[model samples]
Target: MDLELRHLRMICAIAEAGSVSKAASALGLAQPALTTQLQRIERAVGGALFLRDSRGTRATPLGDLVLARARLVLPAVDGLQDEVTALVGADRIGQYRIGATNGPVAAGLVQRLSATRPASPVTVHATWSADEICARVLAERLDYALVGACDPSLPAGADGLVWQPVCVDPVWVLVGERHPLAGRAEAALAEFAGEQWASAPGDGCFTACFATACARAGFTPRPPLEMDVGGCIDLVAAGNAVVLCQGTVRAMPGVVPVALTGSPLRWRHLLGWRPGGPAAAAAGELHGLAVQAYLDVVAQRPRYADWLGTNPGFGAQPVTAAAVSRR
Candidate 1:
């Protein structure tokens, strides 16, 4: 009758899949068995967790509330299990789990970490938002994450963690190669007002940072088309829409990344981790590794690299002791 981790996971799976059958399939349980289990869980929790209809299953108000708390609890429990397992088996001690926003930095970090510690197997989760990565770190699911957030918006709540500033990145506009303004070195943000934009939705501060920059340019951007990362880039390549992204963004075959006039959109690269954890203890070493990764990625792109060189302020700076003290 007591609520257990398995019970919480089952409800979460059902809520997310929006169907008991699909959730059962995902969990490798028989439909009838899952149904029986769900009934028992509802009895323990004192209410029906899901309302089923032809449309699909939906979480009830109480179910929704429980599901929110489950997400926060489940990851921490998983992390504790990993920690205990590591203590019992020294060989498993070096496994590093990381979450990061999708970009060259995350790719480069994985490559460098592997080379730096061949014995440590690296597991990565590439996401659209640094805030999500930091949340995982707080939950003890990630050793650390490379995140970026600008003024007026802090990444991952800016609480219960260490924040190490790695570098400053400017946001750039991307357009199709054949577009009229593609060859321009720099253009005012207002120049692209007529163009449609495609960007990944719900990326916390990223969407707001872009909007604030646009607002400063004397206009508000049109509502963006919600899509995945590939879709957003594809829209740019097709000349149908433009997108805004970090300076670390790679140049696509048919998509050109150009700077904005006066560098309106700027964000700082930060290393997010639990205070006094392994990451904070080894902060200097990780910071150096990240700097090399950024340089390596930048060197591969002729236009972006050239711009980066001329703009001396854009590259990684050494992580100072004072910066670590602030956390």
Candidate 2:
């Protein structure tokens, strides 16, 4: 429908906040201004869009479909604006749909990507699992996907693909301050094998990498209490369990990170995108910048350079503050 930009934003806001008044408050828009826009949108569609009730506004079955489309399309329209601006040299802009299994990678990449092209638009969405991200890239649903240091599972009927090694980040054990192992600089896996485990299981690499590290230490880890990064921190900090995460995980509140002893678990990031596609080159550019951002965050530590070293002659592009605006 030929709706105004406010109509789209109104729908998206309503969907997110679950109420028109809440959306209006969040947008700093008066309730009637938003109500009029919603009415216009619904009229254009020939029926009511939201099911208004005592609690708030909920999407009708039709409204839910429209809301979902608005979520995907409005950002895509912004992306189109970027691409057009870039073509005229008025901007360095493009739309990127990246699939990843965790938050830090998405957060850091957004920082660098926005820094690279401040005028360009970038949207990051989280996939519930790494396997889902991997498959999304292959199916062309995503422009690129970042896989964790992965197990060597092969594709059954793969033809053309480009897998660029991305970042190699140090994996650490997250523990409570009162825990016995926390005071030690490092502890062998066997030393903490019996501890209850908590982890983010969305990334196959993280799960396997940690579990394998535990197994190589000579015992199977009990089933983890799967949690998000915050819950993991809260659980571990309460002295209920031990968890593993990369360096940035230390940035969370209420959690202290400790180095692992014996053999350290090194996670190598893989940049997966379709080979020979137009995005392949862009994906490479993204990987280098992303790795640099991770390095910049952890430069004091030297051991986590494995994947950065994997790219031979990786200087395909020079990253600079000025270059961020140039794309």
Question: Could you say which candidate leads in lDDT?
Answer: 1
State the displacement of the C-alpha of residue 25, model 1, in Å, after optimal TM-score superposition.
Answer: 38
Q: In model 2, what are the clashing residue pairs, if there are any?
A: 116-324
Task: Give RMSD to native, each candidate.
Answer: 10.4, 14.0
Model 2: runs farther than 4 Å from truth? 1-93, 151-160, 203-209, 299-327
TM-score for each model: 0.71, 0.58
Clashes of 1: 0
lDDT of 1 by residue, 231-252 (tens): 9989999999998887877756
Number of colliding residue pairs in each model? 0, 1
* Tens-digit per-residue lDDT, 1-327, candidate 2: 356544676788888898988997775545654675577578788888888788787889888788777888878877875665456542322666677656345667778898987875676557444545655555555667665643333221122345665544556788888888777756777787778998653423345456667778899988788666678788988999988776445344556677666335765555566764556658757877777766555454443334224434321223433211100
